[model samples]
Target: MIDAEITFRKLEIFLCYMQEETISRAANQLGISSVSVHRALHSLEEGMRCPLFTHKGRNLVPLPQAHRLAEHATEVLSKMHQGIDETRQIAGIGQGRVRIGTLYSLTLDTVPKLLMGLKLRRSELEVDLTMGSNSDLLHQLEHQKLHAILISVTDSDVDQHQYEVLPLFEDDIFLAAPKLSTLSDRHSVDLRSLKNEHFVSLNEGFATYHGFQEAFKIAGFAPKIVTRVNDIFSMVNLVQAGVGYTLLPGRLIHAYRDSIRILSLSSDYQMRQTIALVYAHNQQLDPNLLALVAEGRMYARRRSEKR
Candidate 1:
């Protein structure tokens, strides 16, 4: 076992002295006094419990043990540096990968556009995506399982003190039904008129679920619910099969244009979702997150311009 007194710093100074072949020159290379260099070498020799040098008049001559120690010390320091770099990469620091979470519905447009833009800006960066409900994503982000999340902030109680939020865009919720439904001909849907309709809804904790509840509250009656699904795609599938009516965000319209009919909500029950990128405030300066924030800003600008 090595003595605790023999430190990485001492090893570094020893290596420099071995290369420079003189105390004054090693000190010059390391920006320290010659006495400090000599003292470090002496302390290192004492820690090793072996003679590393022989004094030849004013010069210190390296023994064979010193040469062997230098070789091993170089390998140890190199490995240490490699380990630190790998750890930092895995932590999403300094040009490392970023893990992003989003709602299943965003996969159709918002997520694709943002990720594509991110790729263009950071070609070497690795992006991992996990899709879930708004609440699940927020929970994962809070637990440090995700580097950032793209989600609806309007429905979530996002603590401003804990997170940095960058608003992406507002999505209007529309009444969605089977393609051939009679409601397709209507310009706008009033929730009160649909009180007798059986609806399929997303489960609680989803962003859209809050909107669903709010719209019904304004209508003053709860519509019969056929079922509650966990994901938007499943809800859309049920709607397409004519199981029941559902609400959808405008961003998902293009993906099911032929399978479902989307109509604007009447002013009395109109609901809009504000989507944003959310991450821990402490990680605001991380390089991977910085890239994500820049990409989010660009995406928001493009969405605004298109509107």
Candidate 2:
């Protein structure tokens, strides 16, 4: 039997404090004051009528009871998040909302066209777009935080067995440098020739990052990276400012064509990014998701034919 005084917040505070090992760290993680964290933790212990932790100077050491409680707390929080997702999915289905994740780069061109085509098929369909790096989107999809995601399977690391991947389009990576630069003006350049050049790169979570790593390895020299940006837009901006050069996909060439020049690398340096829609096979298919998947397959066929 549990009292009404015990609540989810108390449980959440308990978990946070347990993981953080200090009241201050827990307070920071929860975005609450230390006093509030202390109060919540104390209230939780009082409600359960057990001591979950013992103070060791500034740190709180969890007892065996706390460890047991933590396992149940994690399950409760996960189920709560899943329940919220289910409720939203049901509510949005009637109003035509589909939760779709996408890479930051696709938001420029591919996503818009996909959504427009989807609207043509189902006028009431509304796409709720979530944009992030390739890895982050996949994680959200796995956790049921999103219905589907569009990511580049450029790296062989995309686990096909875990996700139902529908190939969308292919894009090639090219060296991007400031306009009128020597590499840009050259008919073609060996990748190794630019081994010593300062480079701007996307951080490791992106498929492009892995592509760059592979390309550099093939060239037999490590690039002197000027800096790494999480977003492609910022990476392009850095290249535009003459900070350094970078590798970017063909789909984005038209956007930065004026400020930056894309150079054709030797065959050995060529890398392709395959854009795809991925989802857990176990997910429930809604009408909107079905329509969007159909539109993506149609769009891919049209794109391939043109190529």
Candidate 3:
């Protein structure tokens, strides 16, 4: 009985010979010697128990058996390439699971919407979502604990070489305060103008806090910080309780619009935070990662259109 598990190389050689009509020419195209090509053709014929070609002077003519085998060979090669491509995509070598880290601010808004779109398109894909401070998330991404991270970019700890940072969105920092607070005179407030007021902000190691500090510096004032919270939700809660006004990303205001009022900053003290999708330079491409990136792009486009 002929072995069903025939090598693809043998089939490739046979196809090359069938196309070129001469062993020397086929060998030249395949970058192999004519003798090697002849041996491969003989081995393939012997395994199939059928003649594949007939020599006609300088050219080789395809026999009836050769014609049938050629058709099957073409199909086999096409399917093999397709199977390999699909496997690579699923294995994170071409496409696979995308482990992602993000901040709590984005989780309630852009990230969920993007994930929903991705799930609709690729039902079999897996996503591992981790939430943390920007510094912690960036560390996880660098150490390969996560495939990529969505974070707020700050100026102090910028490391461009280690990551492929793609800016997804930008939003101004808003002052969230109680409706009856003394500082809530209008819909907008300046950081320098409220320098004497108590402030609530994210805990240490958060990029937003660092950025807020820089904004204070640029405004030529230091805030009287009253309390520090860990996440945007906590900050909003504190602000709502009249504990203190807190600086938060505009996206958070949109997500938790009912909890607090968003006050735009004055021109001299305006601060914009940039949201970025960051991945390691050497990270492997996977189907899940590709799907996430595609979803992120879609989300960005939709947000832009709405603006």
Error of 2 at 155 (Å): 7.9
lDDT of 2 by residue, 224-293 (tens): 9989999999999999999898888888888988989888878988878889988766553666777888
Q: List the residue pairs that clash in candidate 2.
A: none
Ranking by TM-score: 1, 3, 2
Residue 260 lDDT in model 3?
Answer: 67
Selected candidate, larger TM-score, 2 vs 3: 3
lDDT of each: 0.89, 0.84, 0.79
Using all chains and alpha carbons, the TM-scores for the candidates as numbered come to 0.71, 0.67, 0.69
- Top candidate on TM-score is 1
- Ranking of all candidate structures by their lDDT, best first: 1, 2, 3
Ten-residue segment with the worst summed lDDT in candidate 3? 88-97
Clashes of each: 0, 0, 5
Runs of candidate 3 with Cα error greater than 4 angstroms are 1-96, 154-162, 184-187
